[model samples]
Target: MGKAMFEKEKVCFSFRLIDMGNGSQVIDESIKTPMDALTPELQAEYMEVHEQLAFMKTIQKNNRRETERGRKLVRNPLHRLACFCGLA
Candidate 1:
């Protein structure tokens, strides 16, 4: 009976926000819950919240990567001037 129920719902992904020394850390993890242990309605709510939180973290990660890339591509005026003088 227990095995049958788990096979139906499958495993879910969960995200947790942790506070570190400087900033917050987002952790993505696989969570296994026995759906039969909770009311069906509550199980549905939990899974919904889990997926939304994971999606939020993914968005944050992509934005941070884009910001870093933009910084690297910036032109340094001093370097450009030196190169123009053939000092480089």
Candidate 2:
């Protein structure tokens, strides 16, 4: 008979949950923006703006995905509301 390897490895997590009454979600601290450190040099300032813009683009993309997912979840209720209120 072969010995079973059932040893469990240690895992760590720092999850945080936030509720907004209607729904709840997990928060990730890594998404937070860093402190601004702009310099007087025009090129450096432009580069900083470019970097911030790229970061914003990434965040906006993520928001679009999340919003789509949320809309999917609430589609039934929203559609019913639209029909009931004659807004559709």
Candidate 3:
């Protein structure tokens, strides 16, 4: 990972967390391996936005699938009319 180039208030923030695999959720020590410099706040914001976008994409995909299923379905005239209303 490339280091963060931007500096805030003349302070270059670098944060890294490592998991010890001891069934602990929180990381005790800082980054041992060299990683890209990134501010904790910036990384958190990036992750939050990334997760929100992923969730929105998932919802859109599901809605598209539902609409496609509605369109693909073929039945009697009454059923078709009912489904047409559902598509709207």
Which number leads on lDDT?
1
TM-scores, one per candidate? 0.45, 0.38, 0.44
Query: How many Å off is the CA of 34 in candidate 2?
Result: 27
Cα lDDT tens digits, model 3, 30-86, are 423222354677567545645665798899999999988777666457777886899
Report how far residue 21 has shifted in candidate 1, in Å. 29
Q: In each prediction, how many residue pairs overlap at the backbone (N, C-alpha, C within less than 3 A)?
A: 0, 0, 0
Return the candidate ranking by lDDT, descending. Answer: 1, 2, 3
- Ranking of models by TM-score: 1, 3, 2
Worst 10 residues of 1 by lDDT: 10-19
Which portions of model 2 show Cα errors greater than 4 Å?
A: 1-40, 76-88
Clashes of 2: 0
Tell me the deviation in Å of residue 24 in model 3.
37
lDDT of 1 by residue, 1-88 (tens): 6778667554443433344887855444553445555577867766776788779889999999999876654466766687789976
TM-score of 1: 0.45
Q: What lDDT, from 0 to 1, does candidate 1 have? A: 0.64
lDDT over C-alpha atoms for residue 78 of model 2: 78
